[model samples]
Target: MKAFQFVEWQRPGEVRDVPVPEPGPGEVLVKVGGAGACHSDLHLLELPAGSRSFAPPFTLGHENAGWVERLGPGATGFEPGDAVIVYGPWGCGLCMNCRQGMENYCQVPGLPSPGGLGGTDGGMAEFLLVPSTRYLIPLGDLDPREAAPLTDAGLTSYHAVKRSVHLLGPGSTAVVIGAGGLGQMAIQVLKALAGATTVVAVDVSADRLQVAEDVGADETLISGDHAVTAIRAITGGLGAELVLDLVGVTSTLTMAAQMARVLGHLTIVGVGTASLPVSFGSPPYECAVASPFWGTIPELIEVIALANSGKIRMLVEHFGLDDAADAYQMLHDGRIRGRAVITPHD
Candidate 1:
């Protein structure tokens, strides 16, 4: 099996031949069909030695979609050759969060907290071993490349938008910042699920803003000092009721706060490492700020259904497993307009 691994931090990933993983009890082995390169993967590779959760020599692609190659004991309802999407979050099957179908937030007895490619050997190879059968969700008749991004970028946006849906009324507005992979998905999710009359997207790149508009954003703003003011003007001085910051940097988070109406919600969904200093302002209206993790399994199912129904469209570029470094560089350089997928079959 060929895999791309992190031999060291702040260095290029290495492509090597490793032993193919086998399914253990209650586990399944998936032949990698497609794995999306997430921004977090780029960040993990750039981590300055001591800040990373997982060390070197780990396979690092999490957003996985493939066919079941082998199934272990007690892995019922799925058999070899069955098309499936890996849920990516591994957790205890009996925990409270897992019981509620929120395995992404699992924190319970006898199980470690769920972490995807960052914590375990992921699917940037010919074969991926799913630690639990519960993480497998069947993808009926959908292309694996399209389903790959839904595991993380799509689900993360879905969860972030779901939080402030009530605020995005017919007359209300929303502003999505940094129109990258997650930002592009956020626009589609806001249009499909939240009925915001005004969907404004902000980014430094015109191409990304164009992608955002093509998806469903009512307007796009080139991010800068004028971005927040532009959003406020579009909302008729009240500003948007929900502002999603997909860039999580200090500037974008500050702009989100500046563009949100009093009593509005600002959802931070990006993985950038910048910090924001929060303070009370004049005529404060109970502003709520939060950071959302990858969504629950049921939410992933809903997102898949949304894609299956043709409501959400995925824009992807395919790369071979050997070109993992190029894929990472494309993402780092903002050269990818949408999601970049690695197909192990190559």
Candidate 2:
């Protein structure tokens, strides 16, 4: 079986042949239907060696959906040939957070994080071995190939928007920074789930901003030094009631802080490592800033339901497993308009 693996730090990932994994006791093996290529994978490879808890030689696709190939002894509730989406975050399943289905914030000690993000083996392979049946969510009528990105890009954006939904009301404004894969979904999610009448999308690329407009952004702005001012103007000087920063760099974070209204919600969902200084008199008055990791299982289910209902649509480009490296290159170069899904059997 061919697998795309991150074998070395600060080096490009490679495709190599590996043995197909069989499901062990209490585990399940899934035939890879599709695996999403995410921007965070580039950040993961840029970090210095030993920066993350999990090492290389692990598969690298976190957003995954596939069919059940086989189930191990005692792995119940699902049968072979069942279509499911792999919940990327693998947790201890015993902690309070995990018990509540927010395993992305698992508090257990000495456990690796989610799959593909410095954790266990992921789905960028011919087959994936899921540790337990708890992580598998029914795909329903959604095509796994088109549904892969929903696990992360869709679910993560849904989680962030759900958090700040209280601030989004009729005539209120919601700002989305970075109109890439997640940003595109965030725009649609805001339209589908929130009451905000005005949704603004910001990005460095005019093409991406156009995509944002296509997805339902009431307005689009070229992100730059004047972005904050434009957002203020759009909100009639009150600033946006809710701002989602999908690009977490210093400049974007600064713009997010400036664009958020006093007492508004600023949610950071990108993996950018830029640090923002916070002290007395810093940031907007009473503005709440939060950085959520990923979505919960329940949230993932909701995201899938939204997709199944056609309320939200995912724009994706398909690539074969052999072209995974090229897909990553396009993602790093910002050439992809939306999410890229790797189809192993394509």
Candidate 3:
């Protein structure tokens, strides 16, 4: 089988030949239907050697969906040929968090997690070996090819939006920063789940802001020095009650805090390493800030349900396995309009 992998640290991943993996006891093997190309993959490639908990030479697709090729012994609840989405974060299944489906916050120490980006092999190849059948969510009637991005891009945004939904109500305002793949879904999730009458989307890209508009943002703004001012003006100087910073950089984090109302919530979901110093005078009084990692398996199920019902849609561009490098290049250059999915069998 041909797989795209991060073969070396601080270098671009390569497409190389590798043997196909078979399902082991209590595991499941899935034929790769689609794999999302995430910005984190690019960031991983830029890190110094040994910086990541997971070493190199592993397939890199975290957002994955596919059909069951085979089920190992004792794998129940799903049969072969079922369409499913692979939950990206694989944690030790025995922890309290994992027992509650919050595997993203797995607490077991000194154990490497599974799945792409988590140290285990991912779904970028012809087939993927899922450690347990529990990580597979039934896709129902959704197309596995187009449904891959729901695993991360959709689930992450949904998790963030779900947490702060209390702040969004009649006459409330919600601001979404970095209107890219995750941000677009965040916009729609806010409109559908949050009762906020005013939904604002901010992004550096005019194209992405346009996508925000198309996906239900009531207002779109080009992110810059003036973004905070524009948001305040739109909100009658009260600022937004909820600010979801999908791009967790210094500027966006600063803007999110400045644009949030007192006692509001600001959730950082992006992977940028920029730091924000919280103090008495930095962010507004009583405002709460938090950084959430990838969502839990239950959230992924809800995201898939939302996608299945057509309330949320993912805009994706397709690429074959051979063209996976070009796909990553396009993502790195900011040319991809939405999420990019690599179709291994195409």
Specify the highest-lDDT model's number. 2
Per-model lDDT: 0.84, 0.90, 0.89
**Root-mean-square deviation (CA) per prediction:** 1.8, 1.2, 1.1
Residue-pair clashes per candidate: 0, 0, 0
Regions of candidate 1 where Cα sits further than 4 Å from its true position: 108-116, 282-284
Candidate 1: worst 10 consecutive residues by lDDT? 109-118
TM-score of each: 0.96, 0.97, 0.98
How far does residue 248 in candidate 2 sit from its true spot (Å)?
Answer: 0.7
Q: Give me candidate 1's TM-score against the actual structure.
A: 0.96
Given candidate 3, what's the lDDT at residue 299? 89
Clashes of 1: 0
Q: Which residue runs of candidate 3 sit more than 4 Å off their true CA positions?
A: 110-114
Compose the digit string of candidate 3's lDDT tens values, residues 1-346. Answer: 9999889988888889989997889999999999999999998889998896668789989999999999888888888899999998888889899999998888987442647786678889999999998899999899888999999999999999899887788888999999889999899899889745689999999988998899999999999869899989988998898899897899898898889988988888999999877989667889888888889888898998888889999999999988998999999998988899999988
lDDT at residue 45 of model 2 (Cα atoms): 80
